[model samples]
Target: MTNQQLLTKPIGIDVNQVADSSSEEATKAESSKPELNSDEGLPLLLKAIIEGFVDGVLILTTNQEWFHANECGRRMCSQISQGKLPINSIPEPIWRVCQSLIDSREWFSDRKRFLEDEIKVNKSVEFRVRVRWLTLDLSRDPYLLVTLEDQHQSTKNSAITDVINYGLSQREQEVWLLKKANFTYEEIAHQLYISINTVKKHLKKIYAKQKQLMQH
Candidate 1:
């Protein structure tokens, strides 16, 4: 359905009417008239528009505080939360993710996926977010359209293959031997005078190579 149709039908709000009217008119059409502190079903059409979208909709306050969220969005947030994340409640990880997004709009728009680094929800879920920038109203407030999707099996398999392709360098092998001898990557990095991320990258390469060889 069209965005207007969805909003007008589910939330029962007249977007055009609200568009022509004041922000107060638009607020009146929302469920519970939240900002105005009044209670009522948000215009059916508006509600439907959000709920029907493939992406989860989360409305945040001007202060960047959580205001409300749709079902899919709510579930996505809860999955990563390790517990229920009620309305208005924010998790630190999510907060960090949002901050990073706001900090790097370009990076935020194009999320990079790494092998075995797929963001997991709760424990073992592989989650990816497709986001779009949104401006809600006359106030020109900023919001985001975040779509939660599961990676295809082929994608995951390909990632493993890619990691294997970039397998360990000679210096990495030296670190791996020490790691096998119970040295932490940090300790190895310290001894090798390398950064922790570099050490981890090397180990990832080592791990993928070992898996590849074993498969052969």
Candidate 2:
């Protein structure tokens, strides 16, 4: 969780190693309620990688109990819960998908299943939610992996895609993102740790690229 930590390490989960280490009975019992604490149950490296994800990642039991959630996941859960602090429970709208998935699993237990839903806050704001079963052991029940994506951030990403298509350089793309967010030149410079004149230079180049794209 610090800059001193390097993220270049390859991450992999050895399911065979984990499964071989535990007894069948233990795996079966633990599968009924797997440990959600990343510190105790998951590798520190895996936890760090999950935390670094832009989208929210949540793991929940079939009974809808809280298991583990990355930071973005918790934030989205709070937002869905209407700014409720200490999101120890799942939101009703999201839980509906889980409930549906669980009920459907009764009829099709052998197949991998996933469900999707969207939560609308208003006309302009919404979150895309997807839920699916995550199985660690063959003999155990699968936990639910719910991914939450913010539509607002998705819109920003789409805009960035357009900036890329317009042939903006990497620095120009960064400058354009801040500019699109309505940051002043001084603010953009401060945010990027660059001189104000450099910000203007980037903007000037960005505008030229946009103009050229329009002409084409």
Candidate 3:
């Protein structure tokens, strides 16, 4: 089906369309980019796109067989499995969510196409698992696109990105991270082995840098 036809459906964003759009944008940015052979190249492009994601991306068959998983996805699977399962196997916790989605598809038909579940290993570690149907061909059974997001890791990554964008100093970045984690001024000072006055000073500078960046 054409992208227009695919968009007309309620199946959420089309991965193929995203890949195509991204490729077009890249080509515009770099006119000298070599052309890709449509059939084989598209799948490779899709895999590359998935690999670039910060969150874990897994494309699996209905029976839970792994069709494709990026490096982040593999690492997360190992974490969820506690390094006990084979490298290619999906962790039981994640598979449970995928199975629930599969069951929903079978019993409720198209009533549900997306499902999300949060699995917590402890107070500080958790994964936001999202499963959705991915239909590449109308004639074939739809596959599952499972994304595993490490909540803590994602938060830290966002904070780090902001630190760079705002041009935070080394000391200011350390203070900023502690502050973002909900640490009290005193706690931040203790963690950084500095006086509370020093902690406040770093935060003031960090805020000023962020404000300056935002105004531009």
Candidate 4:
């Protein structure tokens, strides 16, 4: 079956439908599985899901060569390179950051070193970029994953706005809101698209600010 067909297939059987059935009947029903072209279809399904992401997904080799790019990533590359896809075609600031990481060689050991910054896509547009090192098997060739989000978009919610009223910076507000939601520090970092160290920094600032307010 095609990727679309595989995606449209029911994910799991309904428990309610089997609630009234005999144990043997339910077992027989569970044994009946949908035909999936797993070997060939899985990659296509993954590609479709990655391409569907709003943030651009880009993969590059340690040497800075383009390895893969989703649809959104291609659009970002086009904006930066004017339809070209060469190594030098990437915006200078982004390339420099990537080069620095590659040069340090520390990322191989400290793979959690994720970088986040902004890059101007054009005279009127800019994008927030997040870069992370992906540790794959040495033989598979290591790659860096870059995700780009439009800077103009608002990631804030009402909870974040409430935190902002308490005199926190936007980043701090994000951290506070996630903390209020009971998200762990690592989960907050992942959800906010920031590094764990950055999350700690935000929390530190937030605590200091909150303590100062409490003293008043």
Q: Highest TM-score: give the candidate number.
A: 3
Clashing pairs in 2: none
lDDT tens readout by residue for model 1, 1-216: 111101111111222233325677667655443233223234455666768865456654435676556787787667667676665565554454444445554543333311111355532355564333444442345554345554433354554454446465678656765565456868889989999999888888777777877798
Worst 10 residues of 2 by lDDT: 1-10
- For model 4, the superposed segments whose C-alpha errors exceed 4 Å read 1-42, 82-89, 154-216
lDDT of 4 by residue, 1-216 (tens): 111101111112222233337888887766653333354222344457778898888767777676667887778767766655664256565666666656655534545455666777663456777666654332244577778886544333455655865688777877887776557989999998999999998888877877887788
Taken over the whole model, the C-alpha lDDT of each candidate is 0.53, 0.74, 0.75, 0.63
> What's the TM-score of each model vs. the native?
0.41, 0.60, 0.66, 0.47
Best by lDDT: 3
Candidate 2: residue 11 Cα off by (Å):
16
lDDT of 2: 0.74
Q: Rank the candidates by TM-score, best first.
A: 3, 2, 4, 1
lDDT at residue 86 of model 4 (Cα atoms): 63
lDDT of 3 by residue, 36-131 (tens): 436433255666788899899997888778877889999988888878998799898888888877776566676345777887776567888888
- Displacement of the residue 113 alpha carbon in candidate 4, Å: 0.9
